[model samples]
Target: MKYVVVIGDGMVDLPLKELDGKTPLQQAKTPNMDFIAKNGSCGMLQTVPPGMAPGSDVANLSIMGYDPKKYYTGRGPLEAASIGAELSDDDVGFRCNFITEDEGRLDDFNAGHISTAEASQLIEALNQHFYRYGKFYLGTSYRHLFVYKKKDAATLESTPPHDVVGEPITEHLLKPENDPLAIKLNELMYKTSKILEKHPVNQKRLDKGKKLANMIWLWGQGTKPQMPPFVDTYGIKGATITGVDLIKGIGTYLGLTNVHVPGATGYYDTDYCGKVNFALEALQDHDLVFIHVEAPDEAGHAGDIQEKILAIERIDRRILGKLLEELPSLGDYAIAILPDHPTPIDVRTHTSDPIPYAMYSPGCESDKTEAYNESSVENSFKNSSKELMEGYKFLKFFIDYSQCKKA
Candidate 1:
């Protein structure tokens, strides 16, 4: 089995923020990441198309070589698969977000930051009410990824009402502009909210003096993923190390095993050292290990450039640096570092610009002089594969082509 370790911020950004001064990456002191770049072959990656929503869910799919256009059914259902919610062929999956509803309008997206347990309980109650025919899965944080299986493919979709947070909940599902199924979804959203307002979970939280889980935001409707398992693609049994349910959900959906480790948090301050070791361990059992460091992206989204740098540096010093030092002793392992996409702190969203990436061996060396900007690694890369390619192209990066039969 061959080993390839992909490490970096895994989010393709939308050009939401204007380029004013030096980008956040340009300003950070990430010696470790810089070390990896100088020691490896560098290049760029575009994980999403222009003008599409800036979501890592789709972008990560692209990086794994799954074309978003072909595989993205919607964000929620893909996540639903990871949570073990079986969806029907016809049933659509929608990403359900927990939000606050004030006078029928989306007030805030996170529903007062309702605790994950509260979120899970609220979903259970919603399922108890509507799951008579379909499926509902509540995950960590205030996310509910759902699947409506065998319902007949339909063209209906909805997300949290945009922008204005404190207005009356809008009738997103019932609009005539959408397919009749969307109208049904809207009806379902309204009913779901009403039931949630009094859900036993919400009631329990409220009774316990906690915030009530009140509303839902939905987006990204998708069918199940249709691809060979990673093992089939690269001869390495696939395993993943992730703390966030979103990434975990991706692994679960893609038929990869989740290697859970103690002290791993799926948040900005997620343990870097712990995450790195987890990936290294997976290498013993499998050939490909997708190690995700989500903090830099999170810091950028928060628009805190300083925090973003710190997050970047933290991973570099703690994770990438150590990996580089141990390469010689690790035998035949290959390491590649690249951002999934641009998550710039300046605008607090994803960007469309090409991200700088580099692949390095144990003792290779180079002369890139920048820390984290895309410019540093541009010279190292030669071929630009437009967007992302799944399986075949991704696998070729690993096993020598001589190992494969002609197509």
Candidate 2:
């Protein structure tokens, strides 16, 4: 049986008064997602475990059947894997973000979703300037990797720029009590800011009235991770399709095939239809295919409620709609759809909320869920609580519903 998992990253949200107290998922036109709920079993899946930070790295690992508490080292090493960067036993990798700063305040975490071409140039300049401390390698857009040639590099306490949008950078800068690496990282960020402020890229961006990619924010540091191959974990050949390096990195480390779709950006303008087409082709040989869409999450981070609704609608029409129409030709398949975590529009960051999920396996008894949303699954179906089924176990239960059904 073919297993398909589509992750709408950070698509879940709280009710908003703007939409008459209805969430984006509740109000958006998601007929395809609704159809999955109508035909299959629906429930809530706590992607983030208790006492864990609700980052995509931890959450997606749980969703993919790997216990993050055991397998997760950090976000940096994961992205490093996507870029094919080899880390030594003592070396540590860091997720270096190109950010925009204004008047000592953190302006934009994404540097206005900077293009890969422009960001590559900026990363090259940073490497040229700071060749002594560490080396920077370009990933995609603002997301890049920095390999620090030191063992204690992971101990530095740094905050994610997304978590401190509009806050003073001085308040959130890296704080290391006695660690010299942390002090150098903080100094590098400040020095990079001054250099990039005078660079031609920022000058052109300023002239064009675009947000400048003026500073480097370092966080999410870790060493290499040890994970079994996807086949060994599930006893099935699987592949992953995503626009973000973090997801691709996880897939890479697990020895899963990473399918790249042209024009797949980790933003609202990402190619949803392209991802759908690629995933369909991947399922021709693979037993399982995992597709991740980052648009809804980007919208949530921007607090663009309408854009989030539009993103969900696009996924329903361009991705899920096409999948349901074409999967019948492939073979007997089970499709699971849910978000990794909630990037609530109000909070504008990841939250530790149990996300709603739906799984449609042929011949499985439907729980009579009519719509797919935060509230519908709770009210209409008898669902499993986070206390009952952990996120890492959800995949095992999804792929082997017969065994789980009897248990």
Candidate 3:
């Protein structure tokens, strides 16, 4: 049987008063998602385990059937794998983001979504200056990787830039100020600001009234991860289609094919149709294909309610809608739709909330879910015997639910 998992990254949200007290999922038209809920089963999935930060790395790892608590090393190592940056046992890979620092505060996490072309030049300059400490590898846009040789650097507590937007950079820099590694890294961050401030890239960005990627924030550090191949764990060859390097990195470690689509930008303008088309092709050889979209998550980070709604609609129409139309031809397919975590509009960051999921396979018993939304799934959970399933368990449940019904 063909399996398709469409992950609308950070697609779920809390009810917003501006959207008439309805969450984005409820406000957006998602007939394709609703159809799955109506014809199959719906329930909540706790993608983030207890006491863990609700980052995409942890959440998606859980969704891919690896318990985050057991397998998750850090976000940096994952992106490092995606960029082909091999991490030695003593090397700590860090997620280096080019962010906007204004008046000693973290102004923007993404620096106005800097272009990859501009970011490449900055990455070169970083390598030139910081070769003694580590080397920086360009990934996409503001996202990059830095591999530090000292394994102790991984123990330094560093905060995610997105989580401390508009906060003092000093307040959020690598913690335990007495630690030599933290002091050194924090100094490197300050030095980075001096180099980026005078760079031609920043000058050009200032001229264009765009946010300057004026400093690098390093966090999410870890050594290489030891993960069993996807086939070994699930007995299915899987592939991944995503614009984000983190997702690609996860797939790389899992032995899943990272299908490259030219138009998948990991932004608001990301090609939704292109991702689905690539996934469909990958399915010709793969047992399961994961289609992950980042636009909705980007909108959530920006707190753009309308854009989030638009992204949700685009996923429903351009991705899920098309999948529903074409998957019938592929035969005996089970398709599932869900978000990795909730990037709530009000909170504007990843939350440890149990996101909703809906899955459909031909002849599977339905739970009588009226629609695919937060409210509907909450109601379904209240009425049904199914507790909120762990994120890692959802994959197995999705794979076996249909077979058990047919039996």
Instruction: Rank candidates, TM-score, best first.
Output: 3, 2, 1
TM-score against native, each model: 0.81, 0.97, 0.99
Model 1 TM-score, 2 decimals: 0.81
Model 3 error, position 176 (Å):
0.8
Pairs with backbone N, CA or C atoms under 3 Å apart (clashes), candidate 3: none
Whole-model Cα lDDT of every candidate shown, in order: 0.62, 0.89, 0.93
Candidate 1, residues 92-211, lDDT tens digits: the string is 777777777766666656565577776777777788888754667767676677676634433454443333355556645433445656555666777777888877777776677765
Clash count, predicted structure 1: 28
The all-Cα superposition gives candidate 1 an RMSD in Å to the true structure of 4.7
- Candidate with more favorable, higher TM-score: 1 or 2: 2
Which digits, one per residue and each the tens of the lDDT, describe model 2 over residues 239-358? 999999999999998889999999899898899999999999999999889999999999999999999999999999999999899998887888989999999999999999788888
User: Local error of candidate 3 at 61, Å?
Assistant: 0.2
lDDT of 2 at 135: 92
Q: Cα RMSD to native, each candidate?
A: 4.7, 1.8, 0.8
Candidate 3: regions farther than 4 A off: none
Clashes of each: 28, 0, 0
